[model samples]
Target chain A: MKPVEIIDIDVSYGAKKILEAITFHADAGEILGIIGPNGSGKTTLLKAMSRVVARDSGEIRLDSRNLDTLGYRELARQVAVVPQDISIGFDYTVRDIVMMGRHPYIGRLASETLRDVEICDHAMHLTNVAHLTGMSIHDISGGERQRVLIARALAQEPKILLLDEATSNLDVSHQVEILNIIRDLTGKITVVSVFHDLNLAAYYCDRLLLLKDRKVYATGTPEEVLTYENIREIFQMETLVKPHPLTGRPYILPVYTHQSGVGTNRRVHVVCGGGTGSDILQLLHAAGFTVTCGILNVLDTDYGTAMHLGLPCVAEPPFHGITPESLSGLRECLDDADAIVVTAMPIGRGNLDNLRVLLDYRTKPIILYSRNSNSPMEDYTGGEAAAVLADLETRGALRVEEAEELLARLSQGYSGRS
Target chain B: MRRTAFITIPALACTLLVSVACAAALGPTGISPGSLLSLPNAWTIIWDVRLPRVIAAALVGCALAVAGTAMQGLFRNPMADPHIIGTSSGGALGATIAIVLFAGAGRPVFAFAGAMAATFAVYFISRKRGKIPVETLLLSGIALSTLLAALLSFLMYTAGRSLHQIMFWLMGGLWNVSWDDVIVALPILVGCAGIYLFARDVNILSLSEEDATHLGVNVEGLKRILLVLSALVAGIAVAVAGSIGFIGLITPHVMRLIVGPDHRLLFPAAALAGAILLVWSDTLTRTFTNDMPVGIITACFGAPFFIYLLRSRMKT
Candidate 1:
């Protein structure tokens, strides 16, 4: 049996519904993450699984047993939850708090035995709160208090552990520390956690249950569930989704673009390559420019950014020279353009026609863009590309550093014509 | 809990024992230690008057203090007490009903029934989806207490000859405590013992109801059981001692400061300390204040202590 199997559960508070038709299951030794925006019922879903908030019409099963049939202590032996944070009302020592997790095991008449003490000690050691056993809970730091709470959950020795944004309040390093501790327990204990940080969830969770507006929007691997379109649609914002360099998991970088709306139907054809053109492409796109980019290899990062933004672009396959067909596509983009902009990407023989083609557009306003002046342009074409660049510059190809200055000059050109 | 609990529980027990002996010896009748052996009918005075009063005061104090600690821990608010939540008022109304209608027959039974009914009323009124928030709990208690007080005022207005007795009982004291009244208070130990069984559950519960449930505590059930037990204990204390006020409020706060907030240690420590506190308050009133109501003395100190708690709670 799966560790937790929730089928078509609907939860509501009075007249307000929280979750509807939620169906999912967590397997044995799997770490599942529930991720969503604020008020998306991420925490409410966790509460439903733990039986805190009663479900309206659904069944929750643990280890093949119906959840309704199990007693409170019996269910606690199988599932433990670590809250986001708790404000302890009393001055209890750390040991006293941890030992309370053993409440389900000890009978009403029996106090904790030596074995219970050993289990608590081992739990504290696992979460690194053993040294704070004698300290009052109020005296500990916020991060340390989170670890102690995790230790208390561990002391329950539950088969399934649930967390509700348990590390959301901690700093980056502390978040990493607590997530690493939780990740180490996977494959021995089944873990289901709600995460506010997408990157951490991508790295830590084996599977993700993406929620949107109290519904299961998607559920799959992080790579599948945390897609560009999915995140953009669910969160109503643009984000760049790429594989993490170290862990090979999906890493989401939010695209913070403000709609400048100043392009004003003036088409600007950009000749750029490598990853150098990705930022300007987004900035120019967000500024409402009718932008066209050209002649980049299919494998180029700039091509990916251009495609993500739905900008029309001329492209070639990887490891191939720019063909006559692509040259015509580039010529058409230049012919229809009000101005031409080129980022300071490296020049090579494979794509040297881009610079040579730029020399032909002398009548059009050609602005050579460089985000930083120190790294102008690298020529791997034996000074031939530099010669072409000098000829273009002599013919009034204005060079501008910084994307803001380039935007100002381009918008000024648009206004100057009117 | 184990470190100081070993010395603290025993030390408190011994202190209660010593305080009871001292309270019995010093009263308004003047039974000094030196003249006790030579005085005529000294044994009769101790047997018929002093011993029962002192023992009843100690038991009632233990009952009130233990109830207060449980209520504070259950509600997760240190300011919660039996008096603050209308348990004593319910019992006072019950006792007043007995005096006015039945000439004080079956007063303890009436007191207990009224206390339970009032507790359940406040509990149901404050509860929302099986959880009682601190704000609503306190507000409902105040609401019910005001209603009960209005009912009580109307009863006293029509009481006629019983108004004097009702007012005296309303301002709780230990003036006419006897061995029969002591029998009525003896079941308080049974009630306190019942509360002690859930000490560990109360510890987890004090953290937060959700956290307690994650650790396998039956939160709703635990609350119901603890509330019933507290009402029972506080109800009986009212029946015997006539609604003693802040022995419940002040004792738990002081014992929590001394023994920490672990309910296992806190329950016993506060019980002994409460018994000691009320015994002394009663003795001082009888010996020096010309037999004034002990509730007046307790309220005099307890009200200021409550204000200090409120001020410090705001600062924190």
Candidate 2:
């Protein structure tokens, strides 16, 4: 049997619905993360599994035993919850709080046994809170308190552990530290947690269950569930998803849609190479411009970005000269453009045609763009690329530094053309 | 010693024993150890008057303290106490009705019923979806207590000759306590031990009701049991000695500071200390103040201490 499973559950508070038709299962000893935007019933779903909230209609089974059939203490022996940072009103010692976790096993009218003490000590040691056991819980830091709560849960020796955004209140480093401790406990304890930070969920969870507006939008491996299209559809935001270079896990970066109106429906074909065009490409795209780029090597960083943004671009094979086919593609992009923006990129023999071609578009408005005043694009073509650029400048091409200046000039609609 | 359970429980137990003996000997009549051998009526005075009153006072104090500790833990609010939450008013109202209608027969039964009703009313009113905010509970307690007090006053006004009896019960004292009343108050021990069984559960509950439930505590079951036990004991205390205020509220809070919030240690410590406190309060009032109601003494200290708690809590 699976460790836990919820079958077609519906939950509501009074007449208002919180979760509907929710169904999922966790493997024996893997981290299953529940992720969604706020109000997506992520926490409510966890509550149902823990039996904290009554399901309107559904069946939750733990180890094939119906959840409702288990007694409270029996269920507690199987599942433990580490909640978000909570305020502890009384000043209990760290050991005292952890010892309460053994409550389910200890019968009423009986005190904790020596075996219980040993278990509590072991739990504190595992959570790295053994040294702080004698300290009052109120005197400890927030991170320390969270670890104590985890230690308390561990003291239960549970088969399943649940966390409700257990580290959302901590700083990034603390969150990572707590999650690292949790990650180490996975094989021994089947873990399920609600996560507010998607990247953290992606990095840590073995499988992710994505929720959108009270329904399971997707559930699978992180790569399968956290796709660019799925995110846009659910959260209405654009993102760039790539495999992490080291871990090979899918990492996501957001692509903005700021809609500045400076370049709405206006095409600006960037003449850039060697990653110089990356920032300009995103900026133009975000500010409502029809951004395009051209006549570059396929292996270039800018080309990868254009592919991610789905921008139209013309490219030649890596380390090859621009061929007639790619040159015609760049010419067509230029002819259809409202203006052209060129960054100070390294020019070389392989793609010198990029600048030479810009010389042909005399009447099209061109802005020689640089991110900073200090570094112009490096001259690798022995002054030949410089000569081409000077000739273009004489024909009414303007040189502007800074993205703000670029946006300002573009918003003017380039009346200087022709 | 550091107020650990190992040292504090025995030490407080010893103190309570010595306090009870000393209080029983040193009444207004001045029956010293030597006088006890000489005076003819000293045995009668000690056995019939002082001993029962002292035992009843100690039991009543213990009952209030245990009930207070349970309320604070169950609500996860340090300020929750039986008297503050209107349980005492309910008991007093019931006792007054007993005096008016049944000529004071079956007073404890009436008081228990009234206290139980008020406890549930306040609990259900303040609670929302298993969580109770501190302000809502306190405010509702105040509202219900005021309403109960108004009813109690109307009963007293219509009571005519029984008005003096109602007034004496409201002020709360151990003036006429006897062996029969001692037998009546003995069940406070059972109620306290029942609460003690859930000490570990209350410790978990002090975090949150949901947290307690997650840990395998049947939270709703524990809540009902605690409410019934608190009402039984507080109602018993009110029947025995009228509505003694603040012994419950002050004792647990003070003991928690010394012995920590672990209900295991807190229960015993508060029980002993509360007994000791009310024993002394009763001793002083009868010895020096000519038997002013013991409730006056506790409230004088308890209300100011409660204000100080509020002030310090606000500063934090």
Question: How well does candidate 2 reproduce the true complex, by DockQ?
Answer: 0.69
Off by over 4 Å in 2: A316-321, A373-375, A378-384, A415-418, B1-3
lDDT per residue for candidate 1 within B72-166, as digits (tens), equals 88878777788878888898788779877999899888888788788878778877775667678878888888888778768877877565556
Error of 2 at A274 (Å): 3.0
**Clash pairs for candidate 2:** A344-A377
Model 1 misplaced stretches (Cα beyond 4 Å): A414-418, B32-37, B124-140
TM-scores, each model vs. reference:
0.97, 0.96
Task: Indicate the docking level reached by candidate 2.
Answer: medium
lDDT of 1 at A169: 97
**Model 2 Cα shift for residue A301 (angstroms):** 2.7
Q: Provide the global lDDT of candidate 2 against the true structure.
A: 0.90
| Model 1 accuracy (lDDT, Cα) | 0.89
lDDT of 1 by residue, A317-389 (tens): 8999999999999999999999888889998999999989877766788888888889879889999998998
DockQ of each: 0.88, 0.69
Which candidate achieves the best DockQ against the true structure?
1
